[model samples]
Target: MSTTHEVTNQVPPLVGHDVAEDPALLEALRREGAGWAEPELHEVGRLAGSEQAQEWGRVVNENEPVLRTHDRYGNRIDEVEFHPYWHSLMDVAVEHGLHGAPWADSTPGAHVARAAKLFVWGQVEAGHTCPISMTYAVIPTLRANPELAAQYEPLLTAKTYDFGLRVPTSKQGLIAGMSMTEKQGGSDVRANTTRATPAGDGTYRLVGHKWFTSAPMSDIFATLAQAPGGLTCFLLPRVLPDGTRNRMHIQRLKDKLGNRSNASAELEYDEAVGWRLGEEGEGVKVILRMVNNTRLDCLLGSAAGMRFGAVQAIRHARHRSAFGSVLVEKPLMRNVLADLVVESEAATVVAMRLAGATDRGEEILRRIGLAVSKYWVCKRAPVHAAEALECFGGNGYIEDSGMPRLYREAPLQSIWEGSGNVAALDALRAMARQPETVEAFFTEVERASGADARLDDAIEGLRKELSNLEDMEFRARRVVESMAMVLQGSLLVQHGAPSVADAFCASRFAGDWGVALGTLPSGVDTKAIIERALV
Candidate 1:
């Protein structure tokens, strides 16, 4: 055979570089009082960037989870079968305290540290993080019932990864899932028609169908049903006490757009025994705690995707030759790569700031700021991923390049907790009901005063937009997007490198940007911004 088809001009695999070598993330970690965790953060970062870990991400996605709804004897046995690599990913995540462990830690910056770890590990595979995020989110909601929290909190936060259908209490650790959406009431949990009847002995029997229940293989679930008082939150175990399975029935696993390594099932509860969490008629209030934590994950996940995409594009541009020059050296390609780097840095900055809010117990900011970031950052992920993938030209379009996987996973976080409209409205509602949250939001935004003139102007514009409640409902998306960018600008000005900050403000706030990604105005130090994307 002729050796005529030897591959040339092919970009080498992106491996060995520490994924946690992200300057923005490390700076934010040190700035947020979690500098002590830096050693472990790099450890996780190294593992995440290893060729083995990257292969794990690829294998699991290519081999999607399969639903095993019955046994050979035709008995109904609800289960999801995943590739063994799924367990490997989940094992590292739990051991690193990226799941529920941070809630149990007494350290000042425990949550911030965990946030950094999750950001690093999630780049390995985003799908498995669904369960990890749910486990972390459920711990806070479980506290609504002290007794329930006492029983399961230990297992939820345990480092051991116990994967099975055994009784949750018997396991050394447990993974948690959220089963809230119904066929009819997607985000409107109050409209859920699932009914729950008190079973005389401190338990309730639930009867309903959940349209989307992710991580169905997990042992425990935080679900919502209509109690007699009103819609209420409940904790349902896949395996009940005395080694018996609950009445929870798996209807079928959903065929989703992405996140294939994770299982999302349509489920039915036929008088499933569950214990009520919090008071009756307060399900929405109780479950919102979990939603808040998970929304933070949504922001972090989006930021990670951006970082992954930017780094990949830059890595490709550095080595690949195009039009008689390397892509990174080309003027237009340099601008585009720098733009992606700036966006990724901005996202990491805001994400760490929000995680810092959680660590410091800044409830007001976490409540409102989270909604705004969830609305804007998650929405930006898909567009950012698309631009990053295009940097590789036709190579990025193919599945083997792994750019397609990043592109596929980009849009998931936006639709996970609440879609675009739901998130925007939530922020507006928070501002109307809890006025202090608005004060908290602005207070945080004002910290970067005198840092960037365009940011200052944008803040004033946002204030004017929020001042008028007239037609606010119609302008909810507009208001939230403005708030999101202003907050990102403020954080970048205060915490990010001057090059990243200057480029971000120039392109994002000064109106110098265009509809596409590479449209950064000239003189924006593209080389400095692009350099930060490398190890």
Candidate 2:
């Protein structure tokens, strides 16, 4: 035996434990009326924490999806080839009904339970959730036309993973994608020049190029184009009802910074047949439904990233030692770990609350709260991920440590649904357009009044900011940040663990924090917050 390769002082692999064991996740699950789903959630958690599942995540990322524009016989197949493990990962996602099942579920808090499960399993891999979320989101938009919804909703919500290029109606289940942005209009979807013409019947012929289309291999897509009336929403499938391929050109797959496991393509639609999902000029209105749902997923995915980083950082500290003492026993390291746990917990609780709002049909609260949280929580992810990775020192910088992957995936959620400015502006827009949404948001925040003085004062300050609408757009980020902190503080004060809430109020609301992470004030209950992560 070689004494040099002893592997001493290394943290053991984190596997075979339930990722759903966290108290905050479980507490939110119950509070949101999804306690009945605890057993099912644990099942998902166990599989997500398995070594085999972890390997599936790693293998797919290493072997990115390959684009197959043609067959051996020179036929334009327009397909994407993923590593076998990618399908395995997607199979589990579909089998667990993470895609569109919640829309048809009779269970109480269906969306909330699904959101919690997504937050749990996304820790395994973050990319595949993109299509799953799209499929889930497209259901409502597809309902803009009753006939189309009736024809496809069953297959869309089916709990089966039918992976292939086929007629969407014949497939037992379906996966969906979204294609709207073009080079001319990045976020300004109205500038889309993709023109659509009526074919005398109900179908329309679309001809234009998409700058970015996620999950290109999906059975169907919710697309936008300029129709005779104006911008319109339509449902386009890869294979037509007559069993022939649509006139779609797979230009090229994007070389992205991360999320390589999922295929994003530049596509040209050459008179592709599409059925209008909504009336002409209502494309933006219809597609916003899909955007809101995917935004919820952005929140979940970022929270899950936080959880992944915290678990890895804490697991390493518990075992590895320096200065002849365990890292967890050191004072400074403890503050860092506790702060990470606090951030993760705040994100999880608020995300689940929004999910619960969706389930309860509290549209006012969801509309405003999502935009606020999306701006603040997602913006925090990259910073949180960097701090967590630093806890492992040089070791975390390596690929095998998994911290690099987490760090790479962190910035995506913030960039995906909407960037910081867009999200913050959305919150302000919601406040102005739908004054009731702003009222609903504050009503929820005011629940914990008198429970914590810092929270009460924060709420008061937030009100003052809202009253003075001067320079609102310029101060959008600051106003949204205040709203997010107050809402999170209220939730923690009301439902979260006492120590976690205390730490959140002291550092986030009161002026007891530093600019960077791991700067919680002294005398805070570091031990208590860290134990919440351990459980």
Candidate 3:
């Protein structure tokens, strides 16, 4: 038998016309819009009572599960075993979503925001690594290892009333990080030098130092390595089968500019026991999925930071009396406040659209949405933060005042979870696979934008911008800009319209108003009936 098999897989070329023209989907989107402004947040808090805030506040008040405190010479302070605040928050988050808690949709995204703010408050604002670990390390491990699930199910499922980081937080766990960035090599996972060799007895040995492992103290490490086939992922347990220490050695923790508190470790793997995830050459594929989810986290974090910074500036502007009036009273400062609102809300809306795509089980769409949302929000965080900080004047530069932390942490947004460049490349690749999706995305926006007076002008402005996308260079620019436009339209129609007609409106927007129809050379409204809900 041949070890190599030619797998001719068809992705069924996705066209923007199909989704943009989905009448039913648009109708559903329109119907969903009526309740767009429905006070889900207050309602959830009121219904859940202290339970909602209590669980969430733990993440806000306490430090996360993994802590990275270093000494004078940059030596890592060995695991201090802080109370498990981050874990408690995760427990609450899982329960909230599982039971369809009132703010279920909002809770996950909101909790992420709360976690980022809390990190900001602790001055360890830079140590925002738990969210990625929870998604990449914790969730995937639970899916792969039922034994571990059996051990931790209670924690993951149980409803907790207590607040702050809980203690005695022990469970079969997995922690994930990256090693793609090397001294010579960049984030090209395909070029990773980490090697793993089968050690017989269903175990394998991993040898090679990874450049960066975010949460170093995790019991299991979802580390990537290279083999005879191609890039692959391994469940590198921190301990051996006998529960003794494995050869997974930590060389040193990185002294990064921001996210300083999240100890990013450089690891040396010496014949570590590792279980293969999927096929030997398929690690990149599996990890890419995991990374997409992380990108969502990154967007959520960027939004949270923007929200926090905005909140800080608003508070100061309203309270601080400058030039005989509050900072917010000055027209210039007020304009800054308005800018913060727009930027922050824009990011929030994009994040929400990505979340909605995920909730709807559109995995392909979800990846694109996640990529765009991450790029958009993370890119805008610095802009919003700097503006907010400028409003603070000299106070923004002071460390104790909180503005400086946001300034310091804002840049990290563009660096993590597949940086902006990486995200751009991946997004382009996805668009190439589903060329029509780009068009569908925009057409829906145009349809929605044409209807809404508040958004029509902006939509029209964007339309003119895309008109230049006729030639190859223009098409290149159009692809990126068009991606953003579709996302904006999706968000506006998804969240801005009235709730009762959410589905309808969204479908209509997709079909007649989207950029997909305008941009695709071979345009076809495949889902027009669904978009119109005419059937």
Candidate 4:
């Protein structure tokens, strides 16, 4: 007798669902006053979680961008070629106004809505967001030079996306990129040696090399160069007004560990034509506007990663069986999934709150709040991804499981915009320079003080830490972590389900948990949390 093995208890592919339709996400949006945009967000969610989007992500990363520096006739033509699927993904993002939607729309919840869209779309493919984020960030910085803004704002805000290499004057739409760090100065832009000589009428000829020029094929870039005064910001267009290529030479592309779909190039500018932005020596002040916005994107990206991981883990747990029971029914595995759900929900809530702050014109709150969120949310992503991947056991270790990609993509958020140390220092600087920022941060946290005793205790401890200035920088990371936890606890107590808040406070603050995942204390409703996270 011949016997055949049957495939039972295998999980189906997670597709054909609308990610925006998530109950938690929709509730968060409603709480944040952006529920009116649910229809549009649902469309984006559907597309992002679709099989086509998954295929696009695979093909784009597999076929990385190729630099074609010279044409067939040996003439210099700096361009990077991407797979058609990459273009399709970009087209969808651009059409949805992910690039400049908030700036273009002046409604009450514009920023919140745009952030939600980005969060949803980023879960599908994160690499293409390089240009989208840069374009969105460039608006405020470009305003420093009203002349430049007048010349390009319409083009940048245009809903259409022109994916051709042409003069900005001829293109229907445009995207922006940034080149700040140099070989000697990774994050210290002041140490850059790039020299800019005055040409004529606020224009300069820049001659230096940029260590990393993200989205190298973008139509324009905001770069830093040394001028007569000091390091200054300049706008460099890929194609000059006369329809000729700029003197920018693409030396080579960096082989990165992840975000492979985007091209990060090292290029030398041999007297590249550039227009000075803002006054000389004010580059840091001007470019900081752009950095702040990108920092917010980094936070949102991390939150999106967490959500993706949590959903995948929950779905896998519900389907796969082990030890004569489904993983979701296993006590320890249930605890792990529930812990991740709490984490993902906390991140989503904090991110939306920050966006709401931006909409409310809470400048001080936004400044410090962004720093706190950027530091903590991005930092938690790698740990969350690892735990989620472990739920699939051996299958998750393979590339086909999609867990490895999420894991690899997790660290980039913490590193980009600003590293953990940088974010913590920035928070401290905000406190020193603007005491009102501290007040704003505390004011937001104190709203939920009386709701949870654990959160109240954590906040009191953080207040004590903030009072002592001794070894502040040395203790910055610990202080920042505490601040992050207190903030998350406060938000959960105020907005999340009672069970979630209790679980978070008990494990995170009351010391009922160990150092790893799956250590939630007994009596917590782990099954409910897992169900909430399930797709």
Candidate 5:
């Protein structure tokens, strides 16, 4: 394999190197890593057997004849006109849309949906990084400047292709919304000082700089600016209303850690024509809703990348023996690999459930679920990938080994699309508002599991513990823990693909406990206790 990808100038995004070697620290890491355990292959077999899934798989595989030739980045040779793999994803996306892609497939929770989302992300990871998915952002941004909407109306239909006008809304085009992360501001759209002024009849002049614009060439952008009421979303077309120059300038492409295939750039929008997305102050709200897809996308993409890294590590460890034995045969390595596989599955479950809920139009549930899943899995990804990389010994440290790309990319998952801290805060706030929403959320979770009696006992016990706590910090922590439990248990029950009886049982179990738990105090500890009981 080629080692052409550079690593310098790009600091590894993880904090504290070699922390895994510390005995006390390693134990905690080990414990956290074990949360995602290897389940029976049967859990995944349903997806493998799903006719829709199999068909999508065939789409990817059929294109493999072409895909194999390119690097993970979609950099093709001079002779190659177009990578057929692009369309492979479109088929799956349309299929997913038709079959309720991520949510309604009955393949067990959200893993399949996450798998689909990640599949799209991998293409972006391979080389399609543009934050153009901000199509939702345009609605609010254009609300204030609807006059220019006609110019970019074609871009809204997802038919964008080739980075210019008459763009086909190909699978690759969905990446357009990634442009928000310029040097100016990403999640903190309020911080962006990028200015836009009216240039007479409905045309506005734009002036500012941004860093980390994922796809500079995407057809549309869900970018931000300081409008009269507050920060807002804007719809900027790559071309003018008359198909002339739009005046949005690209400064330079950024050199990134991973996801190199999608280039990041410093951008300068100079006297660029502009259209707004929603009402003035509504820009922030609209952008958040629009880019929520990217947040979920980030969560699943990073998780899938972690999964790919683990499989590679396992394959390498199995083939490359040390101490005169295959790595799998060693007790220590076996333990490591076992934990890695299961946790990856667990992460998939968390990510997919959120995707399914969102796909099903369960807005509030989707918001909380996606936020929680993104926070947990994005943070968890590197820990597993790093361990899997360690199994490669010295090979893991080298770019040729492929572990480093994942390691580098892992940190970005948490940082992008609102940091983990932001997501956690948002989640707690949401729970506080609809205290019952959390209960309803968990009820759905419990119903999926058919009443794990121990879980009920554990939650009841935790309720007592939480009821004793008057401290706000402790209460806050408990809320997170409770949410985590519902998320995990709900996903396992709903999507676990157990026998019909088992599914029925899990549902009943979850449904009863969910209602019971909701009736109790907010400071519940059932999930933590249940987790402890399992240990």
Candidate 6:
């Protein structure tokens, strides 16, 4: 006997929908004063949600980059060959100004607008954003050396993206990468043994091995090597001014668990030519600018992951039915979906708020705020992905469901730029070194203090925690988490719906929830929150 299976209750393809059209994101953008960029964001959202974009994401991952160490003639030419889809994605991102739009256009709310575009584009493919982010971040570091900035800034900030290895002068545009980590020093750049010997004309010959050099095919890179003065930042170009390739050799490509579409290489600089970016012994200070910008991107990327997962899960629940009722109508399922919705919105608000601070030049608030948001938002992503996946039952576990990709991508943001411990410690350091930062952070959070009693109480507790300095390092994570919760609650109270803010405060601040999801108290409007999250 032969049996035939019929497809009945499966959800249809979620295509032709604009991710930028998400109500929570639009609301946040408006709150941040970036609503002027809405039409462009809507276009990006349409592309991100299109069927072609989805296929490109899948195909790029399926066809991982190929490392070509040399040609058949045996010349030393190190290159990475990517699938055409990867270049297509890069083209779209560059054309849309995802690489350096904010830096190029210094209009009001430029950073916030760029953040929104990145949040939308990241939902389609994340790997290609690595080079784009590095290119965007290198601007501030490059500005430290005006000569280098004059030489490279135009190329980096150009609207076009010229792919493949080529001379910077010959291309219409350029991208950049970074080589920071060594085999011995993972996050400690001071421990690096790369030696830089002075060459003529303020240049140096750097001989070192970098363990992780992402987007190795880029036209230029910002790296560090020890000089006579101390550890210093250097700008290394792939092609020399004489129209020859530099001595940078690709040893091998890393086999990462995710982000397979982008190539990360272990490289050796055999006396590679490098130009000093800042005064000697100031590499840490100079690189910190780039690191902080990348850290913000990490926060945005994680929030985008949460939005993607929630949308997918909610779409499935709304369509799938069991026990004679649609899954979304089920009481327990509504609670779970609402929990996911609240988390996503909290992340969105905090990320946008940080971007707004950047635009307003609130340096003190940005310092501590970045660390807090980076720690909490990235830490929450893995759990968010897991819960969203569970909402799809067996189908989510399958590769075709797209949930596994999101789950694999969730933990990366926490590990990248800086891990949770690193961010938490940075927060503590900010408080110790610049006590004014704490006051600034509180001032920002206090904007919504009177709106909710529970949030006010949480803010008071956080203040008390800040007063005690003993054992501060050990309790750093807890304190940061509290700061994050209070800040998120404050934003929701100020900009979000009354029901959303009430739900967040009751569960996150007032302790009306449980460890597991689907435990919001009975009177909360779970249905409304879930409906808003459904894209």
Supply candidate 4's per-residue lDDT for 430. 91
TM-score of each: 0.99, 0.99, 0.68, 0.98, 0.66, 0.98
- Count of backbone clashes for each model? 0, 0, 63, 0, 59, 0
lDDT of 5 by residue, 468-515 (tens): 546644355455545555565445444432321232233332443232
Question: Which regions of candidate 5 deviate over 4 angstroms?
Answer: 1-117, 120-160, 164-175, 181-186, 433-436, 448-454, 457-482, 497-535
Off by over 4 Å in 3: 1-133, 136-180, 443-449, 452-482, 497-535
lDDT tens per residue, model 3, 110-229: 333322222222222334344333333244433444554454434433334222212213432223344444544557777788888887776678878777776666544566788777
| Global Cα lDDT for candidate 1 | 0.92
- Model 3 gets an lDDT of 0.51
Residues 496-517 of candidate 1: C-alpha lDDT, one tens digit per residue: 8888888888888899999889
Q: What ordering of candidates by lDDT runs from best to worst?
A: 2, 1, 6, 4, 3, 5
Which stretch of 10 consecutive residues in model 2 shows the poorest summed lDDT?
A: 526-535
Worst 10 residues of 4 by lDDT: 1-10
Q: List residue ranges in candidate 1 displaced over 4 A.
A: none
Candidate-wise lDDT, in order: 0.92, 0.93, 0.51, 0.89, 0.50, 0.90
**Tens digits of lDDT, candidate 4, 389-481:** 999999899898888888988999898877889999999999999999889889999999788888888899889999999999999989888
- Cα error, residue 70 of model 2, in Å, equals 1.1
Displacement of the residue 516 alpha carbon in candidate 6, Å: 2.5
Scored by Cα lDDT, where does model 4 land?
0.89
User: How well does candidate 1 match the true structure in TM-score terms?
Assistant: 0.99
lDDT of 2 at 521: 95
C-alpha root-mean-square deviation, each candidate: 0.9, 0.9, 15.7, 1.4, 12.6, 1.2
lDDT of 5: 0.50
Cα deviation at 527, candidate 6, in Å, is 1.1
